[model samples]
Target: MEDRLVMDGLPAFGLEVGAFSSVDLVTAYFGRIADVSNLNAVTDPLHGIPILIKNNIASIENNNTAGSLALLGARTPRDAFVASRLRAAGAVILGKTGLSQWANFRSSNSSNGWSAHGGQVFGAYVQNQDPSGSSSGSGVSAALGLAAACLGTETDGSILSPAQRNGVVGIKPSVGLTSRDLVIPISEHQDTIGPMASDVKSAAYVLQAVAGQDPNDNYTSAIPNSIPTLPDYVAACNPDALSGARIGVPSNVLELFLDFDNSRQVEVTSFLSALSTIRRAGAEVVENTNFTELAAWANSSAETIVLRADFVTNLASYLSKLSFNPNNITSLADVSRFTKTVQPGPEEFPSRNTATWDAALDAQSGFGNTDPRFFPFLQENLFLGGEGGLLGALDRHDLDAIILPTSFAPGFAAIVGAPAVTVPLGFYPAGTPTVMNRRGNLVDTAEGVPYGISFLGRRFEEAKLIGFAFAFEQLTKVRGTVKPFVVPKTEIRRGV
Candidate 1:
């Protein structure tokens, strides 16, 4: 299955990457499959499943490039905590998938899926449309069934956006639910590894295998010992889970992007239909909740200040732990200098410039977490995104989860370290361009594109989110219908 998909033109892997040989896969199945092995000790729930991990997450056998030329040959001495857990649970480590260069933090104008090391990753549904990233390859591989499931890390929309664009199920667990040890850092506050799969159940299965506390990561200490376990996650897939649930629709959030002049009417219509479906499934729909304060913060300088500061400090710390740094690339400043000497100039790779990195380095000048400016950013984020923000809105409204258009809701979750599950809603017709009055341009809108809706819930409430997503998925049956792309023989021959 893996080789066949690669042959069919799926550019989902990074350097020195290869799938497990057939013999090894068969052996793993025989040793761990419940039907093949009856040993009481062999109780791995993910037995025989093949998982493709994102390149940024360290794997002992694969080079962890984090989609940058600066770390071209860097390999970790051990697997990331999540990767080790997956292996312990009997999952086959397939390979590392491509991602945006530096996980989309390299430049302000960097195109999604365009990595200096792995090139551009295309979407399975539309060959020429944007395959949102920096989880580009993971999402595409899952959507195309290249592997049973894939792992993706999110600082913000890295996991959710790509999953939505590729029409797959993506769950961004609460920050500490999955350990971040050995994974490349964007922001400790927001960076988390999650699963992207063809369905919510598969995603939940992967999540169960990976979610746990790791002593190496202090954040995981916050995860309660009695947190939802694997069985709870599986059981939550009940189709009737939405009954009597109250879902809030923040008009302030939706209207931020659903302007009439934009070409997102199709998306708006699909969202309304989804709301109707949720209501039909016995979930009460709360309309037009005012989240003006939270929405304002979403566009404020707080996010930029916090993320930039965190990126510099966290990335330097991560680099300092490397067992081998052949190039001595120890800081963001070094990375910035290295890229300029080798990569294409701004004329071509507009997003690979050093401006962002420079700014981050400047922000961290002799200032650690003690910087007064830094604390305000974190304090404001906690207030607007925490108890006084998203949590406040939910508590005040007495809602189960907030249902927002998939497009912008992920950002809110990232800021607050909340968990969110996105599932397919529907697709727009061919030639239907996305909203033109937006941050990025829509590519190949002439080809039909898929849109998904997200269910955002309180921190560590993944079971509820997964259950709600599963119910909606079962009711809608919106996934699995989109056909995978098969490259033309002529194009393959020409290496196009």
Candidate 2:
């Protein structure tokens, strides 16, 4: 009667994100002893394969948090598009992973990975540390090998930060390539779901199985199924990808980190050295680019204004369509109210309200402080004037892609909606040599931490990005996996 589908080191089959291994996971993996006739077909699609989902996607008829307590006991009527694909691919629908409450758009001060239902997902390296949000649990689970891979959604950095903090591969697909009919929303313009895996190939495999045009999502109509269907990802891992490829180094992002964290210099040292490998690989590296104008443009008030408009407008439509009772609240207002209850179950709201309220207050203050010049600066300096911003930079330099660090530092913190990818460069040991800042100041590492160099491209260029990442990974293979609940033991690899 023991189900062959059951396996150790697999994720739970129920709904809670990053819920510890449980009887349910065991049952899902191995069919029930009494159900022999059905047991033959009960093989976990994800049998030996383990993966986690962001709490937003509904699978296994379990609770869908969307990182909000309002839907505490709510059961989504059906499996999300990606969840169905994961199941079909023979991947175990591991439990849902934690995320920033409401994908971190609900509040400004809302920590990146905290949710009333899941609390905070911890970093794989340091247990008492930040597992960068929205997709925090997915990144953590992938890094620790609690599962073979995991899924994470992003409006922005949610996928990237966790990947950076957990030291793994995180890819944010083109917005329209993947369907979003059942997943929670952030911004239709930017919201997307992608894979968080131990390496680039695994992430590509998940994407291959799940990506396609959906009848439900209108935005997807514009993207061709052939584009997402391309399988060159694994084949594109040419160690020679760097050769003949033009890479632009944004001096602006480096300067921004220089101002924020002195330790960033230590992280960049390995990154710069990694760039040398690109040169050794025969790529041309261009430095001393002035992208300051573009950097400031991205963080301006105009962007926030755009986000707010979409948040209110899109959310209203989504809530109006949902069919639910009073207990199953749907709107932001209802969620805010439900977050205040002191209940015993995961839906208990008192603690969550604190994070939500603080986020709201911070958002208001952040908006007020944003400068108006930032918008025109973007139009004139980056997009129009052609200094940088993916497309502009790529065309101006006649390049394949641009490279930059995924984060200012290797450590994690709270933030919402930023999608990023971290590939191996080389390790920056605890006492490694450091780099000089814009002001020509030198610095050293206080501790050993992993750092990565990133390649950026125009929107919808994930295939290129993945191809480049595959090449880089094949060359370096720096990513590592940890045995769950155990302390890390190896020196982190770089640029893999």
Candidate 3:
């Protein structure tokens, strides 16, 4: 396969016409990824496609380490539900991409894409770009077309942020849309698995393969029973889907992020220009729709209180279910000890420290979500993200979906487990000044760095978001406008 060859199993992959065999595609993608995969008989949209999964998601063929050395060699009894679904849908498991250690929940001081086992993953957009968290590897690899696309999990910004930085399309489904069983957890309440792909349609195909209710993950039970069969997400990619659709731009959300991350001006200008695109595309734009208590909501401790408590409980549950544990790491505390004690060390325990885990453990009250404090915090979260936040904004503005620059969107939706999709919006100008990451090793912002626009909606509404994203994606086609510092040499390594 060639380098940077963007595909979402586009028509004429040569498989259906017998131009090449599934084995041929596999061998072509060999250097890009590898693993145990059987050619399936069915012809799903994802069939015969090569896809990479983030390291945190468990699989039988490789060590499911979540980018941490502590769980090295640990084995999962079976593939994570998403992995099995991908295989069943005929996607070849190319290989696992590296991720932020413990999905970027381990250390507050850590770099976005750094991992103990994989070192650090740098984006191809520029030298040492911050590759944005948790799903960092998946996002960058997708943009460079390392595989057909890559899978990622989001507790909050894991998938979206990385996708935006890498100039790829990412869909962060509602909490229960995809199963979490066997995928490592940060907070069961917030964690979700979704795809980061070169385009929205490809993402839809990847999502179509894995989405549906799973008995193992109770959260999936929340998916509406009225719809007996999974919706055909690919069919939802209507170019005219945005025509007559009511889309709102929450000015307050944009206000909150105006000075965030120091990469502005272009985004603000691009966003203003994109609103005209949205209007010209026939979507009714509702501007200045404010989140009634956004400031109060953002200032509250409810989200943090809920996440830390859930993490303590969720991590223990995931470890307990692991079939084989080399380190006997049964709880968050046990894992913490291993990180600090492991010597000749890449963990950099003394300097980095387990501050995030320390805080989680400190909040650990010998109970999980069932604790008395949990429900109240959840209630506050729902009020903020639900009634007074995005939900209220949608209902009050009588909108189909709310749009914001991707940077401003994730947190609000995360609280309510609402679905969101981030599509390429714009890139920084050529003369833009560079901004270095906190650790000062990676570039946080600079000329040619890409950003995105997100469409956030009510729970289980991904199909709608996909349609709007596809429409916006088609309108701007921004990904192609920005060129990376380095483009891959080959689009494909053809196999005979």
Candidate 4:
């Protein structure tokens, strides 16, 4: 199956850049099924399943480039904590998938799927449409059946956005639930590895395998006792799980798109249709709920300040740990210099320059732990995004979870270190006009795009989110497995 997908030129879509030998993969597949009884209970759900680890996640057998030219050909010294767990659970490590260069942190105008090392990744449904960032290849590969499931790391919307755009299920677990050790970093405050799969069950299976405490990451040491004793998530995928579930619908999110004319109407109608489905499933939908304080914090300079500072600090820390640092690149400044020397200029690698890195360095220059402004920034971001924000809204509404268009709520969950699960809502019709005429002129002939709805839960409330997502998935059956792209013989001959 893996060979067939590779032969179809799925690599051109940037789904996979490198993989283990077929012999090693087969041996591991058989070895896992044979060893499962001792390592796991009789119900080792992921036994013999093949999964792809995102390139940024360390894997000893595959290159861990994080989709950057600067780290090309780099090899991991050990498996990432998640990767080790996947192996222990009897899953085959298929390979490393491509990603947005530096997880889409290199430039403001950079394309979502474009990587300096792997080129652009196209969407599963439409060849030319964007495959939303960072986790672009992971989402595409899962949707197209290239792998049983794929691991994707998210900071903000990296996992859910691509899953939404590609019509797949993505679960961004709470920060401490998944270890970030051995993965490339953007910000430790928000970064987490999660699963992208064709269905909620598969995502849940992957999550069960990869999630747990890790000695290397101090954050995991404090995991709530509730998480450790939780039941198997695969057993929690009840079709009637939404019955009596209280969900809040944030009106501010809808208002953000209310002025887009027909597109806005279509999206709103779709959202309302989803609400109808939820009601029919016996869930109470609380309408017009607003995250008033969250909106203010999201719009403020606090997020930018913290992210910029953390990116420089966290990335520098990760770089220093790399066992195969051939370039002797020890800091963000070294990375900037390497990019300038190797890639040269914007004219040659138009969207892959180091402008964002330079800007982050400048902003973070005088920042330190002892600085009064530094700790306050972190404290305020957590306070405003957590207790005073999402948790407050949930308590105010007496809600079990919040549902919004996938695009709107990921940032909220990310900032608060909460969990979110995105499932396919529906797809816009082909040729549906997505853009409005600013001069009051209507435009036609736009490509269809997939949209998803997200379930946002309190910190460490992954079980609730998964149950809701599974129930909604079973109710709608909106997700479809995509066919692999067939490379034309002529193009194949032309070496494309």
Candidate 5:
């Protein structure tokens, strides 16, 4: 759509024409599948719908730049598994959405939605609202109905946080449920891609198209062999699945939110109400399901050690696969130099340094998972997500899912590679104070800025979590209530 909007047979048009009037020029229409996909049209749920992928996901037609200037013209060998799956499901490739530069892995204290290539992306709900990200652009795209839905990659909070902030549904799949081939890397162990859509069922529909094995991504081979085929995720949108379901709430995890963000406690006002709603829907809301070792895990440097070690190696692997590399960047050290030494100041060095890259390069251990100390650090995380965290809470409480404020929920599952879904919870009140983040430009709180509740569970349990999210979504229909300040109406009519 970016290409379509900027280029055509015409000369000067957008200068005078309103965005709504240039509708025909904006849409990137493609041929609808007949026998192209192996499945029937009836079975291809996303057939004919236009879907957007994040800028990082490699597509042959688009540059897989990860919003960095260095890779601006670089091409990919083929579509990412996410993109290929969308094509296989008879969906149209709408285009790419912006992301945090290097999926928010580039620098410390960087703004959530700013990318050197994509510019600063803000939420539509309020004036300069912080569109929580790496996946910020995708979340905002869905929030504004730019397409049916948009796909976003998550190594952690990228998908979930932005979805809540944007008043939409975001599914952060358990790692390995979707292929990461050709997508930009942060940490291979945690990186996974999922859909951000207007609602739970819509997200499920999108997830159904892409959830499967791809030989290119060996991580996907981890899908249980016993399950010859994946479950019918769309059908799993059972509105009544919440009935007689046992859901747990971790007070300890919730307590840590105060340290994470000042407004974290206030933001969960509706989350407290969501518990009552869950109870009325016939789900038992088990309280005080504590992650006793959460404090210890949070205080430890285990997660950082894992991410830094993984990143230094994983990033090089991604760079090695580029079909065309304009800058001859084959390593993080090369990328760092390009960002620092490049004449035009495109990388914003003084403001946003390559400190993260520097740290990764300086990692005491050898390349990532191969490091001898890697397993011990990984085990520390496993303990947090497993016996000490989300997994442990589930088994200890005999729970179907764990519910928490979306802002506070992603970490436990992230460390352990478990699935989590966030649905619209509530918005800040009309008189809420405007708050700015460390970046000094991005707003953290304001009137009508959205928040969400999350349902997290074991790996490969996305179907069950989606069911619960669907029930909650149907009950609330809260997405409709909160409207953006400048509502975008993407009515594709005839060209002028």
Candidate 6:
């Protein structure tokens, strides 16, 4: 396989400068392993496009590392439901991309996109800065055009944050819109996989190919029958789609970390810029939408106790059933101890291991019905009742959709089982707001990094979101490329 990839031409995005450091490595790998001759479609039909699947995802022929050494050499007996869908659609499975260890589930202060097996993945547009975590490599590879599209899973900020950093379009589908079977688990309740691509159209195409029913994932049952079919995602991109759409600018999401993360300012500035762009594109922009009235709900605890319990028990059971050896390490406690004693490879990227430690110590919270932290009512309704709440606003205003900064603000924060998406609005100015200090001071950082506003709407409203994004993209037409690298074109990889 390595020999067949030796004569590769440079990737369209030029990611092969110093070493096989980016998606070029993925493209090269696919050319070696797959019989890609029958595939067709690049960014449009998505049939034959080369796709970089995150390491956490299962590909029968590849290792499912989840960016951790713990799963080293563990081969999946079959493809993940999503991976199978891609193959059936004629897509080539490009090699896996590097990611934060355990999708940044290990610690709190961990760096983004640093994996033990693949090292650190840089934001292609700005090589020096962090590529926001968990699914960071998938985002970077897509941005560099290593493949026409890539698959990224999100449990919170993983997908969206990296997409913003890498200058690409990412969609973290509704909780159950995509299947979770065969993908390494964080929290079954919130885990989902979606497409990350160079543009919204490409992302939409990939999403269509992968979003559908699966016996392995019962969640797909919740998908509505009224929505247009997956292949029709491009229809959402009406140039006038935003013409009369009412966009809600939630002031509270903007203030979520105001006291601790000053990066909010840089993001706020960018959000304002995006709002202006939306208005110029002819949308009805409503600034200062409030979600604070539901603060109790928005800030409600995630009931991680339930999540942890499920993880340990379920994981142990799953491992036991596997044909592979069940190490003396069966619980999170054992895994934590193992990680502490072993030094990962130099290319390894680390996420905050402290969080994993915290989760492990508190695993008992999930053990029995005795723990008060186990299961609690989903108290807040940010997605439910307020003017800024997703459903409420959409119903009240008869809006076509709404847009936000894609996140509270970006920095390095990891949470398991949450989902979201990020899109590129083009480059942000120097000294963009970033890192926060204990003193509550905001530090300006990550100059030359890309910043994008996020579009979120009612659950299952992906079509609207994608359409709106496509409309914005068509208006701006700001395609980005990675900083040039000096290397042989023959060493780079192309699409599947």
**Candidate 5, residue 371: CA error in Å?**
2.0
Compose the digit string of candidate 1's lDDT tens values, residues 1-496: 1232232212223211434344444333233222212111111133234577888888777778777777877766788999999889776686777787788887776667766666766666665567788898888777755556889999889989889888889999999989999999988888999999888888888888899888878898777653443336767888999999999988876676765335666777889878889999999999876564755675677777787788878888889878877778998888877777764552234444656676777743434344676888788887777665667678889989988767767777888899999998878776564432123543634345778899998988999999999999999988756664542221111111
The true-versus-predicted C-alpha distance at residue 44 of model 6, in Å, is 26
Candidate with maximal TM-score:
3
Q: Order of candidates by TM-score, top first?
A: 3, 5, 1, 4, 6, 2
User: Which regions of candidate 3 fall more than 4 Å away from where they truly are?
Assistant: 1-12, 32-49, 225-228, 259-262, 363-367, 493-496
Q: List the residue pairs that clash in candidate 3.
A: 1-491, 1-492, 1-493, 2-490, 2-491, 2-492, 3-490, 3-491, 34-94
lDDT of 2 by residue, 401-471 (tens): 66777774211100111223467554345454444222222111212334565666654566777777777
Clash totals in order: 1, 29, 9, 0, 0, 19
Question: For model 6, where is the 10-residue window of minimal lDDT?
Answer: 37-46
Give TM per candidate.
0.85, 0.75, 0.93, 0.83, 0.89, 0.78
Candidates' C-alpha lDDT = 0.74, 0.57, 0.81, 0.72, 0.80, 0.61
Quote model 5's TM-score: 0.89
Off by over 4 Å in 4: 1-49, 226-228, 257-265, 343-351, 363-371, 434-446, 481-496
Where does model 6 exceed 4 Å of error?
A: 1-49, 226-231, 256-259, 297-299, 303-310, 317-321, 326-329, 342-352, 363-373, 377-388, 409-421, 431-444, 481-496
lDDT tens string, model 3, 148-267?
778999988899999999899999999999999999898888999999989999899999988988899999988884235767789999999899999998887777777554357678
Worst 10 residues of 4 by lDDT: 36-45
How high is the lDDT of residue 392 in model 2?
Answer: 55
Task: Look at candidate 5 and tell me the lDDT of residue 133.
Answer: 83
Candidates 1 and 6, the one with greater TM-score? 1
Model 4: which residue pairs collide?
none
Give the candidates in order of lDDT, highest first: 3, 5, 1, 4, 6, 2
